[model samples]
Target: MLKGRPLQYFGTCIALLNMLGMGWPSPFLPVLERDPLTSITKDEGSWIATTYLIAGPVGSIIAGIALNKIGRKRSLLLSALPFLTSWIIIAITQRLGFLLLARFIAGIGGGAIYSVLPIYISELVDPPIRGFLISVMGTLTIVASLFINILGYYVNITYSSLICTLPSVVFLLFFPFIPETPNYYIVNGKIDVARKVLSQVRGRQIDAEEIQELVESNEKGLAKAGVLDLFKIASNRKGLFVCLGTMGAQQLAGIVPIIFYTQTIFEKAAADFPVIASTSLLYVLLIVFSAVSSAIVDRLGRRPLLITSISCCCVALLMEGVNLYLKSQGGLNSIGLSWMTLGDLSFLVIGYSIGLLVLPSVFLSELFPLNVKGLAVGFCNIYFSVVAAAVSKLFQITSDHYGLHVPFFVFSASSFLSLVFAVIVVPETKNKSLEQIQIDLRNKDEHNKGEQTHLLKKYCSEQ
Candidate 1:
């Protein structure tokens, strides 16, 4: 037992709860659609996913304001309430209308939790261990996702739906034990409380001078910031673009469609196989692989991991596209023992687990400065949610109109573009301080413009 470090344990527990609650509902989408209570058409089924993604961005934007005003502990407890209620409603109602509404509400809670946790962790933990701790959140979510998919495979629909409620219940019960973020306390001028929380979380008495320095630094940063000030900073703009591009690339990598509609895709393509069982097994395996990838992300550095991951994703997606194209051409229909299809699907999952599935959150946390971190993360999440909604709808529409290969081809092209963007625009931020990153980006931008200016000056002087 790490004495006096209740906050660390509490944070891990909260993260685990949030992940379990949010991720478990995901694998149930296919099963829900198949149930009599929610016999949705393919388009309508996609809307359920769309609703969650749309709600995530909206909820993320609201989270900062809510946390600033209401306080972190209170906000988290309040957020979990909706998920619990939503699960109960889902278990009983069985109406498509009610189901959508419930999912949207649950999504709001989940989104808020996701948007806020990184900021809270950054503020609370020491720098050396922060990456490891934050990565634990991703690991736990993947674990929960794997567990839930397995449960959904064997359990009855009603039971599976009911099982999603456990995390929220656990969250609400345990939330009271965690302390409010020390930064949030400082922001509100509760110095005594902030000091106490910091001491407890750090498992040692923080030097008063150090705490005062932090408070002073925070005050100066806050004083200089205005609503539009983030736009005026070149570093902020660069960071924002990187954040947005990274998030967009993560979604555009096509993992969302694969995770949410795995059973559907399997059924549509490999109807002869045990679709549900195979998909469930693959999801569980991918989650395990994703956790392993996340553990090594910090060591590999952001840029190499991102470039490598996106490259692998592009290749995998292209392979999937080629497979789909072949099937469309009736080349595989005659072959009764086509292990090639299975191999291709495994490649897709492996590519995703190794690359796109693991890096977005890690990149986001590393790239942004603390001053505008919360709002910047919130905005990035907004892009993610919007792209997810659009992609989910696009996958359904494209699959119906142009055949399944079209969507995979589109996703592969986007991944290729993302690889180019990563190489040219994204910086390697391994083991670097946030302030150092800001300086590097600003210098890079100045150097690029300086070269252009010199060329213009030479021409003008000659003319």
Candidate 2:
């Protein structure tokens, strides 16, 4: 019961930098490949697109080691530095080497933020609005992408990259004022301090007994666990698989390629709108739909929304493939379905924003306890970076070798698989307390314990 809800907005302000840096290169990538100012080959462009992802594991690894030691707020500040530095590099140098390194550096920073920020958000907010706050993160990301696209639309590459540094700077400056989450204090055994912070965030005094209950509940469950040990426990293992699946499905859904290659796709689709306008509209649709999805998440519950989302994604990808295939046949203008490609692109965002886009972050935030939170999230982001890099690099190669429709069709298949996985693996987390989530995870022995107790009582009675 946060009396002041601005805490969520503050979290979004800091986390927005990662996506801003991530989306900055999107609009400018097409220009970098063919513009006379900084003409690079397709191979170089692909490498540049992947360089950030390739470098992400470094940030995640470092964040895993230092996250708790340095604390969440400080760790987030460190993440901002790389984003700011990378944009500065981009602004100062157009040299291919410099640009590549900059993207990679930015990825390192983005990785740190991606790995740590969701955990921060999850711990900061309560369960009911947890989905909503996380949804705001995705919505802000779309908004940032739109902002960067607008910059690319109006300005030169150097100036636009320079302008990108501003938000990161603001985040770095403002984030330190925000307090660390209560979980961080609890994990450190500072129960009094944890209570104070929680009280502050809620803008009212929390009951000491409530904090004591939370500690007792999570003490054994959240004991100091390492990354590899995450698999040793049944509950932790299941949670790991869910996080991995969520990350894997997100990348395979082809969102990364869509961001990196939006201009290329628009050019090929012969889209009805200008490239800038179309990209802007895509972001707007994503933001609007993600906001709506967030609003409905708690009410509708997690599983149903996720099922509907991936189902729509499969259809969206299928239609996108068909649109590309038909357009390749060269009679789409006469048939007047060129608009269908745009519709598919729109639905891709709309569908994912509804479930796929934001829920994965929420999943990671809730799945692991404080002890393994950093490392577990790091592992997920590491996998995410690998998948992101592979998809982005292979997009051009696959499209060149097998045609654009093939990639879209492949993505469709992946989305369908993910839909099945969601049905089997994803539990409804909405409205459940974090402690309850852990209790549910460890409930497999309830019947066995009950039976044993009954057997013991009968034996004693016979005796």
Per-prediction TM-score, please? Answer: 0.89, 0.91
RMSD of 2: 4.0
Clashes of each: 0, 0
**Cα lDDT tens digits for candidate 1, 1-463:** 2434455856756755766766544556665667785677666767776777778876787786676677767767777776777778777876779878887887787678777776666566655555555656665666767776677667765777688788878777776777777877777788888888888888888888978976875653344344464577777788888878887888888877766766656655665667655666666667676776766766777677778878888987888787778888886672332345555667777766765665667666666555566677777777778888888788878988899889889999999999999999988876665445656777887998899999999999999
Write down the lDDT of every candidate, Cα atoms only.
0.72, 0.81
> Which candidate has the highest lDDT of all?
2
Q: Which candidate tops TM-score? A: 2
| Deviation of model 2 at 38, angstroms | 3.5
Instruction: For residue 286, give model 2's deviation from the true position in Å.
Output: 0.9
